[model samples]
Target: MNILDDLKLQYKLGGIALKMIYWNVACFLVSLVFFYSFKVGVFDFPSWIALSSEPAVFVLKPWTFLSYAFFHDGFLHLFFNMMVLNFSSYLFLTFFSSKQYLGLYILSAIFAGVIFVLGFNLMHYSGAIIGASAAIMAILVAVTTYSPLMNVRLLLVGNVKLWHVTAVILILDLMQFRLENSGGHISHLAGAFFGFVYIKLLQNGIDMSKILSIVLDFFTNIFKKPATPFKKVHKNYQKPAERPVSKIVVKDKKQQQIDEILDKISQSGYDSLSQEEKEFLFQAGK
Candidate 1:
């Protein structure tokens, strides 16, 4: 299949894990096009999209708080972040649902971005920030929080506890906070803090992910096509034909499965479902 067909298939089958990765890659290509086609300087990307460290500029473009997570500064930047994101996505989904993953990701990014702005301003630093590091860090810390003792294998490192991995990373970020890339280091900590907070609140029965769900639904409804008003039909219109028994069973099964998925979403959030489960729900929606 072509790229479009492949994207459609992945979006329909690979669940949020695939969709988030697809977006980051797509945005990277778009940036490349914008860089070359627009003939801008090599490092001079448009500021409208990148999260600005300047509080004044940020106030004007609030959406950048979240948009910045989808952008990056270079090839290695994108690769490493996506790598951690992929790994974290898998770990996170093992315990949470896809919606929870997204909620944690987006909220962490927003929180990190805002804190980056505030922290930098306070520290007398100034620069724009980009990349999904903050959000990715959040996921890493979240999974670590969820299961501190979970062991992970590293290349040439044998195996290590998840908390050790997270702690080492956090320490590195802390040690570098006053050095180069202070903005990034600060944002990383902020994301880390939010990740820790996310799970704590979840345990306390306050799902911060619901805020994202509500926001997304509100926007979805706004962009959704308006429904047609009711109108009387002709009395002579024939009744609709009944579906075949086989089709009816399939339909009932689909609906029943969909209901179960929805209940899971209500209770534990969407990150709890397996990829196969997510794909089934995606197909059911169609």
Candidate 2:
């Protein structure tokens, strides 16, 4: 297959993590066209799309809570966030389902956005934020909370406990809590907090992810088209005595043999097939 077809196939088969990466990358590319300012060399995201600290703007555009997580400020910002996202997704999916992974990502972003807005408003500050840092932190912290002692190998540090990595990140965020981009850091911590809470509640048999699923299903049903009812037909004409024979496809002997072998394999597995059958199937494949 060509490169585009290959990519389409990969996307169709890949898990939620890969799909999330694709979404983030696609959003970044679109942002570069409309949000990025060439003259100032910085992204100028609008209020409707980016998560704003002001209550007034957010109250009108509540969707920004989730939308902002997909856009990024710069190429480097997108690159680094995606890198960490892939790493965290790997660890998270090791112990969780893809549906949970997606639900956590979306819910965490919304939770973090809310916290960011609340914290900024309390401090009498105003600014907009974008990027998946908050969601990525949630995934990382969630997995680390569940498997603190899990071993993760770093590029130069070798193998280390998962909690060690999480702690370092948390400490850095805390140290810079009041420094540059405090709002961003606030959202990060909020997402981390949500992640921890999510695991705790899950241990108690409370699945927050199901909330998103229910909401989605409700909306889907609302928009879904109703099936048309079957109509009864009246008998208007008599049946013919002899109907013409429809065309029938006849397979060649080689193809017929291959089909038999495939059917056998499907029923009893490849190992159950005879040596002659295996060789015939292999040659047919080539």
Candidate 3:
């Protein structure tokens, strides 16, 4: 089979995280197509302008917060993000439900975008933040929270627990906070914090899925109508028919026999049973 067909098969069999990675990879390819077709001018579209300034120009442009996560500026940026997304998503889908998995992904992206905006505005960083590092950090934090002691065996590096891996990543982000791509690192930290906090809140029974539901309800209400009261239906009364005396008497006797049998079974173990008794017990439970 061709490589594209292989990827499609793998994607069909893969869990939620893998599917998301596939989606991000597809978006990256599409962005590349746009980049080359536009003579590499797409990458030069000021990240800050695309993310922050443009939204003010058009209210519908707020979706860039979520869309920007899938847009990478270069091949290296796309490759590392997809690698991290695939690994992290596999770990996430191993435990969480698909809905929870997606909720976390979107929430992480929004949190990352907010942090990126904050850094850009407050710190005056004109550079644009791209890639799935923030979302990957969120997944890492979530997996670590769920199974802190779960060992991940790395090639040549042997095994390490999830908590240690998260710690190292967090430390690296902290130490490199002032680097050229500091905004992206800050966004990663935000996503990581959100992942950890989200898991903790889940343990306490605060479902974040309800937030998505609320958003859905808001949009649905716009196009839907309110329910109207329905009048209750009434039926004409009719007389009942009578049963035969012999049939009624036989049914009462059978009920009494069944009750006695049940009482005997309650006093004795089911192992002390006759064929008739077994059938009676089975029918009674049913």
Candidate 4:
């Protein structure tokens, strides 16, 4: 197959984070070609797709809030965002479904874009923005908040707590707030806030992932399902024989406790689990 076919196949097989990173990289390449050949800046490629910080322009084209997260101005801007996104995706998918991750990423990006525009307008700042930084930040912070004590080994830092890494990143964002690209920093924090809140609400038994489920359902239902054919039967047709229910259906208390511990490991990492719980899971897996 040709390169295009190979790319399509790769995209089909990859998870949400890889798909997102691929899209951003593709957009960047397309934008570069157009910039060199057509004299259009990265953010000025087309009004309907690229995002602008100007309130008047944004009011006219609201979809840019979501679209803007797919393009980057420079290589480093794209590289760092994609790296964090890859790491965050591995950690996030350990506990959450891919659908939930897609929802959180989209929701966080939209919220960050809108907040950036509003904040920029209020401060009379005149600058355009485009990148996946906000969404990447959200994923990183969200996973960290859920499992703060998780241990991660670094090349030079040995093993550090998850919360420690998150705190360092947050501090850098805060420190850069007054130095340069303050609006970008604000958008990052907005995404971070959304991530933290999304997980907290989930722990309370309120799932926000349903928002993306609705969106997916709408798109998938674009072609309606064929209706069932009408059936005809005799007036006194007898019903089919019923099957007996199984004697053992639901799991007992021990099984239930084991399932809970397993879920906890998925969320907070195995190290956060007690020794007893770890041994139980190990034995059960065997």
Against the true structure, whose lDDT is highest? 2
Give candidate 4 regions above 4 Å deviation.
1-9, 36-46, 225-286
Q: Candidate order by TM-score, highest to lowest?
A: 2, 1, 4, 3
Candidate 2 clashing pairs, residues 3+ apart or interchain? none
TM-score of each: 0.78, 0.80, 0.68, 0.74
Return the lDDT, model 2, position 198: 96
User: Could you tell me which residue pairs clash in candidate 3?
Assistant: none
lDDT of 4 by residue, 1-286 (tens): 3446445644654578778788889998987766434444333557666677876788899999998888877778888888888888888888898888998999999999988988888988877677888888888888998998989876689999978888898899999998998878988999999899999998999778788889889988887787899998668767978765453333466688877986785588555777576556555554
Task: Write one digit per residue (lDDT tens) for candidate 1, span 42-97.
Answer: 54557788888887898999999999899887788889889988888888999999
What's each prediction's clash count? 7, 0, 0, 0
lDDT of 2: 0.88
Write one digit per residue (lDDT tens) for candidate 3, span 149-265: 988887798899878877998998999988657778888899998899889999999968568767877999998987898989898887867767998898898788878876675
* Per-model root-mean-square deviation over C-alphas: 6.5, 7.8, 13.7, 10.0
Lowest summed-lDDT stretch of 10 residues in model 4? 35-44
Instruction: Rank by lDDT, highest first.
Output: 2, 1, 4, 3
